[model samples]
Target: MPSRARLKPRKMPTQQRSKATVEAILAAAAQVFRRHGYAATTTDRIAQRAGVSVGSLYQYFPNKDAILVTLAERHIDAGFALVRLLLREALAETPPLAAMLRRFVLAMIVLHEHEPELHRVLFEEAPLPSHVRRRLRERENELASEVSRLLEAHPEACVRSPDVTAYVIVHTVDSLVHSFVLHPPKDIDADMMTNEAVRMLLRHLTAEGS
Candidate 1:
């Protein structure tokens, strides 16, 4: 594993060209990682795939680990963005709990399904930098906090401890959705998985005498 300093990007891309170059490199890295897996991937392959020279690649990222960290950061940011978007839409319409959960579950399944192979390499094969792991935990907690507030505001959510219940729901949905998408069973499709997850959550959250 690389040291924290070694995992940091050497420089930030400020100029338009540099920013594009960085984006290309990151995009290429994602493809290379997906095709080659983390252990087999090399910086040379990423650079070639990006159509950038090794020196140019090194200018923005110190090494492959740095690029991986950036990719992980982008993925985390995107996931949170989607979650927030769904939450906002739900709040605006104040939809039924089942409808809201379905939206969230289906969105997550679709997001993971977009690039399951890439995600497998990023999350399972590669070693995340310490900072990236820390950021993930922080983001999960932040998301849980947001969900707790939402549950508190909702009239039907009769959970005794909204905070703890929100945390459980968030993590449960995340873990189950990720597993269902990435390692789906032969018999279960997206619709079935989504319906089952929503049903289970609704039962727990809106259970009789809860």
Candidate 2:
């Protein structure tokens, strides 16, 4: 027998390769879905695009739907990270409520603008499988809670119902920028949209309420 180190340490079998191959397949599938739309995408095409065997694809993701769920999970996690960065950066700065909120919202919108494709996949896509949906929902709630906690620390900010308000702010700002990602408004420049969204968020979270 050859020395253990030189023995080419038994290559990962079809099963282990299946996991990495599946990830590549999913990545390819998401691009295909985005480019061709979900209805037109096929597993064989995804496997071909990923440079993996179709058998390898099936070993991991059972079907196209399963791959979509994987893609959704990826987008959700990425979105959460983007939002979290904004929250952390804004909160770290010395505060007057309006300015901090504005900065945070601007940062987040800019992030969306930077990667609209991923943002679209996360927010504009249809329902995912139940388990993935639950996970995404929980992550959304958790991010909202984190923002609320940050706001709550600044009682002078006078955020009414911090939990509710945080959720509303997050959802609203996302929706506003999300539109830019989904449909580039002809008249509204992207920078102007970012500014306007920041203004809107600041007005809500920090401006005097009627």
Best lDDT among the predictions, by candidate number: 1
Cα TM-score per model: 0.93, 0.79
lDDT of candidate 2 vs native?
0.68
Q: Give the C-alpha miss distance for residue 190 in model 2, angstroms.
A: 2.6
Q: How well is each residue in 4-59 modelled by candidate 1, as lDDT tens digits?
A: 98888899889999999999999999999999999988999999999999999999
Candidate 1's C-alpha runs over 4 A off are none
Give each model's clash number.
0, 0
RMSD of each predicted structure: 1.6, 8.7
Error of 2 at 21 (Å): 1.5
Model 1 clashing residue pairs (backbone): none
Q: Over the stretch 94-128, how does candidate 2's per-residue lDDT look in tens digits? A: 57766766666665666566546645654556444
User: What does candidate 2 score on TM?
Assistant: 0.79
